[model samples]
Target: MNAAVHIPEYFEDCDLVEGEDLVREPAFWLAHVLLTMGDPGEVERYGVDASAYEAMVDRLADPGQPWPVLRVCFTGGHTAYVVYANFEDENNVDFFVRHPAWGRLGHLGQCGADEAGPGLSWAELISLAASAQDGEEGLSDPSQRLLLLLPMLGDADMPGGARDTVARALAGCGIRPDAAGELAASLLGEQDSTGGPRWTVTGDSPIAVCSSPYSPRRVPLGLGISPEQAQALANALHGSVPPTASGGFTG
Candidate 1:
């Protein structure tokens, strides 16, 4: 297949090179995101408030350590991504972490990174990763999401008979009713016309979804998502919070 993405110039000659192939490296990645801090408007984009961002980074990492880490991941496409909250109004949104160094930069639009904003040095970050080589690699692999989701297919834990309805719909679509969970699981890899790992089905669009909520500016749920909405998604995905609770047409 075509390269997952055009390997950016940054990784043009890394020892990890594989003749322009997309090989699974770190399953899950956590870095301080030195570019965001002190960059006015960046910190708030990841949490409820600037202090919340500070508190989290401080709570989780040491001084001069990777703080307010953004989880980086790559699945189907060559891009690695991160989903966080919006700074403007506190909405949970996802965006690209492109560097051309990480094989491909996550975002390729107006977002700028001419130089490191204000934080650790590249050497320091590299050293940190080397030290944590033992850290576990995460799994958001596109092909396996279906299996991860199988247990929820007919579970009573799903709200408002939604699971049952979804199963029926899958069967109607000529998909095996038993593969209902696979369908939903498979969707974790997409949304709203844009490719991403985050997904949401609005009350307005029961049969569809939107992905990649942040671009330093939010796209509409019809297009992407906002922090408040992302938080609602978190609640639902974790608590079986019904779509109706988020004011949906589906209910």
Candidate 2:
């Protein structure tokens, strides 16, 4: 008998169920996304280096390499990913970016654990990748406000008071008060058990912040505020009393 005819018989001893669960599996979604991607040549028009892009594609396609452990999709149809390449080493994770436009892929670099601090979280990686493409102003777009707050929202060490402060600040940026709070709460719910490390302000020239030790990325703060104001905001988010003279965080 043909192998096709024995397909059912071959799996008769295996347990099977019919429903949406199989379709909803991570493996299924990964395969679907990979299959739908256009030819990598399309990415060349954007000026991406052919060799590097091809190497990234090869690594992703290699079954011997680790599969992407996490994927975050932005409102603008951009996607960020983290692939854990080594289980024994905490720093052996790679960040990758992709957009629906050309399905172009870019490597954001690898992150690993270090004695200095914590590594970047998937949310921060998404923000960095998005900002690189759309610039800081894109982060402040009213439609993307929630995404802008994700790095802070996903910080497990952020205090409730700080969260409230951030929500109020976001409201000042044009989001409805009630909507802002609800959105923050909803995002928190989604990550209640998976919050990453705390965010710490490490510089002032441009207001840089780090989420963890040995992180390869440092996110610049201040959606549009002065350097001093950004410093105050970072302090407030860390649960410190902002100088009353600083006027508090507006954004």
Candidate 3:
């Protein structure tokens, strides 16, 4: 953690505490595992475009006022397991509300104490969230706090398929496949990689898969996604939309 990042007066007022010890927290650990294998550049590599990626992150940060609990999440690593805030407060919420595609879904909008609303409508909320900024203080790294909130994707605490898929996706972004595999295991709390957990990605059209030398299971390629990519998919799965899309998600 950078000392410069810790000097924000708002955090102090919010009773926020910052430290590396956050890695020990369950939330941070899980998030770290996922991010360890995540590649922040997936959108660019996959041809999703930089602006689209940024817009996706913005949407995740603040879903809207009615459904303020959700937040955006993405991989962050200078090295070691790292996470990024995606969304930490009201400004993000307000921006998402006013954005065209995302604003219509009232209950799913991202919300926090920082927003002002006549109870902002869907359109208003998307617009606000899209326009919100970090101000001169710069952005806050609330990765530690956001991880605790990542919803369990399956019946188990961590979804083995989701973790592996995310790692594979990161690998496609140029990370080493072995490292991505290890990261997947770490994020799912599956410390040992020996057990062959079967998984597959069904592409829009069928695609060939290669079996891992280490495991009998075949790995999916086109299905690969980074932490941010995973988060974007998750938001879509949860029924939210990006502001630019008339329907929220791109078909």
Global local distance difference test of model 2: 0.36
lDDT of 3 by residue, 14-48 (tens): 22122343333233333332332234444343333
lDDT of each: 0.27, 0.36, 0.30
Give RMSD to native, each candidate: 18.3, 18.5, 18.4
Candidate no. 2 TM-score: 0.27
Could you tell me how far off, in angstroms, the CA of residue 182 lies in candidate 1 after the best superposition?
29
- RMSD of candidate 2 to the true fold? 18.5
Per-residue alpha-carbon lDDT of model 2 for 1-251, expressed as tens digits? 11111112112432222112212222322222222211222433333344644555444345454343444444344444444343332324444444433323433344334222223333342233233223221233322332332332234543334345434544544445665565345334433434455555454433345554444334443234455554443332233223222222322
> TM-score: which is higher, 1 or 2?
2
Best model per lDDT: 2
TM-score for each candidate, following the candidate numbering: 0.21, 0.27, 0.23
Give the top-scoring candidate (TM-score). 2
Ranking by lDDT: 2, 3, 1
Query: 62, model 3: CA deviation in Å?
Result: 28
